[model samples]
Target: MKSDRPSHEDFPHFQTLNTRWMDNDLYGHINNVTYYAYFDTVVNRYLIDAGGLDIHSGPVIAYVVSSGCDYFRSAAYPQVLEIGLRVTKLGNSSVTYSLGVFAQGEEALLACGQFVHVFVDRARETPVPIPATLRAALEPLCAPG
Candidate 1:
């Protein structure tokens, strides 16, 4: 938690998310688990909207192979969050999404995490090259060195 978190500008894509009442815990703040949900939301929303993924009946699908989060500050219900996203790694069949939760117009991170997804053949459940269309869509979000 001491290292510097990436700024909002570091992300190439973003999704505006509104925290809900159910997202809160008994302590009255959004639970740690909900941050993962936020991570999934922005990643998949970009995949479907920008990556042209067919979640319902496509021959290919993306599965979350790994995920993690680091909470820097607590987020609460009734808060509108800017879930910023970038790709730090893009492989033949997998991609790593770097994400951050931030208050609107804020550069400081509330939370940050990485979500990894492996593209696979739907029926065979075997790894497959990421689709051209999807790869193209993700290119812009891949941050440079």
Candidate 2:
């Protein structure tokens, strides 16, 4: 059977993360739940660094309304993970991010996932248009459906 997992070339942005011993489960691999953390980390780190997202005081904020992951292989503790990210859908108030998880120096994905974030007013908690700066940063990552 052919593998459907994406490759590192599929993503425009990348972040390197180290797995902590605590991330391992009794089964001896990184727990399924930890993959979500990697998803969130890469996304937020991009927003903060490139998009000027002020997590603490920005008037606009992004909230993860939906997310999911598919595992093709397991990763153990002490492994270096290279997270690849791309924007698949960019809407006025929401953005869908496609992510791939790979072991360092590898080209194939160990896992793949997508996360949808809805931009909203920090105080009102109501959906708002994606901020200009953030949208600009995300444009380069947008992929045609």
Candidate 3:
């Protein structure tokens, strides 16, 4: 049966991560909170790699202002996970990402979420327009309206 949920084709970018034994909970599946960690890892990894983000000494920084996830299936340790990502909304200083988690080699979504990041002046912690380079990097990832 085809799922109405989002799929790998919906996203333009992909990042892969491996699950660790430590990620599992007593029930033997990945802990619920760990999904959020996967969300953060993929988003920031993209920012740093494609957006030219300077996590250490950049004038601008991104803060996680909002995020939420929905799980479709349980994933446990020993599975390689793939994150499919796209920008659902791109604003002056903030971006909303639609991220999907899938067991590697699987087409179905194991989980999906929207994660928000607001660019800010590193020192003042006030919102600032996303830098041209970073914004350019993000444009390709934005889903068409």
> In terms of lDDT, which candidate is strongest?
2
- The list of candidate 1 runs beyond 4 A from truth reads 1-3
What TM-score does prediction 2 earn? Answer: 0.96
Q: How would you encode candidate 1's per-residue C-alpha lDDT over 27-132 as one tens digit per residue?
A: 9999999899888888888889987899999999999989998888888989999999999999999999999899877777999999899999999999999999
Question: What lDDT tens digits, residue by residue, belong to model 2 across residues 13-131?
Answer: 99999999999999999999999999999999999999999999989999999999999889999999999999999999999999999999998789999999999999999999999
Q: Show model 3 residue runs off by greater than 4 Å.
A: 1-4
Worst 10 residues of 3 by lDDT: 2-11
Clash pairs of candidate 2?
Answer: none
RMSD after Cα superposition, model 3: 1.4
lDDT value, candidate 1, whole model: 0.91
Worst 10 residues of 2 by lDDT: 1-10
For every candidate in turn, the CA RMSD to the true structure comes to 1.8, 1.4, 1.4
Arrange candidates by lDDT, highest first: which order?
A: 2, 3, 1
Report lDDT (Cα) of residue 34, candidate 1: 87
